[model samples]
Target: MKKAVFLDRDGVLNEVLTERVKFVNRPDDLYLLEGAAEAVAELTKAGFDVFIVTNQGGVGLGFMKERDLKKIHGRLEELILEKGGAIREAAYCPHKPKAGCECRKPNPGMLLDLARRHDIDLSASVMAGDHERDIEAGKKAGCKTVFIGEGETSADAKAPSLQAAVKDILQLLAD
Candidate 1:
């Protein structure tokens, strides 16, 4: 029964394109938010298995190719490792928003799968993200939830940024 932290990819791990309000469509568009790597490293050092659960609907909308998304994730992993972090795995929903996909955010499919494969304890796990859908997924998956950024959400906790969120999560784990 290992603990795990599931993170949202876009706003949680990287800077989302604010002007366009969309996912990073290319590797060039990808930018790791400040302190993100260090925060992840801290979580990794805390002994929690880190994972990414995201809804990459851009692939289904033809905004980006699967290979391009892979490239972005590859670079992200490299950056995290460079900062002394370890990501156990990443799972994403490539279907369109209205595709009724089981793996999308707001659904527990991805989290459930990760728990099954990694033998994770859902009760001891945490899900951190910037959107309500992320919180919803976590709740449905039976894990505590952390919401990043300012907003009205049903998350168990809230923070101004991913770094802050991770710190709060660490405290929760300690308790």
Candidate 2:
């Protein structure tokens, strides 16, 4: 089985908006968070296959179209590739919370699907994100989840930034 790194999109890869940006249907609205490119590059160099699992309910809410989300992902991919990193795949939940979708985070549908398709070693893998939901999803998927937020995690590890998290992962993998 192959090890992988699962990442959250918004706060992990790009700036988490103070207010949710509606109609992120455009590449122009998608922007990278600080140190995101460098951190991804380091992760790539560490030989982890990177994947993004995001919850984009804006589509279900009609705030943005699916095509717009695709464009945003394309832009993100382009930027990552430019930085010498590559995202092997990206999956998202487009359903609203009211839809009760299985694919949403806190459910682990997307991560399970990715693991099935990619033959991922869940135990050896890591999930990094800025939200508790992301950590919950990773736990459900049986991956070592890291919370990329302010508080220290009793459930998983926590880091204030992606760069710091990657550094920790690097040291662990090196050992």
Candidate 3:
């Protein structure tokens, strides 16, 4: 089975905006957080297939469109490739908070789908993000979870930044 890394796109990949800004409707708005590219590069070099799992309810809420999301993701892909890393796939839940969709974080649906499609061994994998929901999803999916940010979580690990997480995870993976 293949091991993979699941990442959250917004606060974990880019600076979490103080206020949501139209859901990053254009490629121009898809910015990378400091060290994000390099952190991802490290993970890629460590031999893990990377995937992005994001909650994009803004699209469902009519704040953004699918085409807009595509454009933003396209730029994100370009940037990752430029930094010597690549994401194998990206999946998002476009349902609003009240929509009760299954793919949103804090739920294991998305990870389970990826596991079924990619022959993933969740026990050997890791999920990293800036929120508790991300860790919760990882837990439900049976993977090690890394939480990044202020709140204390029952996550397997915690770090201050994606870069720091990368450093520690690489060492752990090495072992």
Candidate 4:
């Protein structure tokens, strides 16, 4: 069985406009958050399977087209690769928050599917994100959960940022 890491996209992998331009509807709006690429690189170099699972509700809400989302993801991949990080795959749920889709955050569909497809052991995996839904999904998927940023959580661990979260994850993996 292979160990893996599942990461949320918007706030975890790239910048999220908490105060402005929240949707990241355009490719130009996509930017790697501080230390994000390097952290991902470290995770990949450590021999764990890394995947990005996100809920891009903007697509379903008509804020961005599917092609535009593709462009943003392409740019994200390029940036990560430049920093020597490799994302095995990225899966997103293009549904509105109220859509009640199985693939969205707060649901384990994406993680479960990825584990099945990639032959990953959910018990040996970690799911890290900045939202409660991310934690819930991870728990549902049977992986350890790490919550990024400040907030109340039932996550197994918490960190101030994605980079910090990765550091803790690496430490936990080593223990």
The per-model lDDT (C-alpha) reads: 0.90, 0.84, 0.84, 0.89
Worst 10 residues of 4 by lDDT: 14-23
Q: How many steric overlaps are in each model, in order?
A: 0, 0, 0, 0
Q: Provide C-alpha RMSD values for all models, in order.
A: 1.5, 2.0, 1.8, 1.4
Q: Give lDDT: candidate 1, residue 71.
A: 90
> What's the lDDT for candidate 4?
0.89
Q: Which candidate is the best by TM-score?
A: 1
Runs in model 1 deviating more than 4 A are 19-22
Best by lDDT: 1
Pick by lDDT: 1 or 3, better one: 1
User: Ten residues in a row with the worst lDDT in model 2?
Assistant: 16-25
Model 2 misses residue 23 by how many Å? 7.0
How high is each candidate's TM-score?
A: 0.95, 0.92, 0.93, 0.95
lDDT of 4 by residue, 27-139 (tens): 88887889999999999999987899999888999988999988888888899999999999989999998998899889999999999999999987899999999999999
RMSD of 3: 1.8
Candidate 2 lDDT over residue span 121-160, tens digit each: 8878888888888989988998887788797564467788
TM-score of 3: 0.93
Reference-based lDDT, residue 117, model 3: 96
Cα deviation in Å at residue 111, candidate 3?
A: 0.9
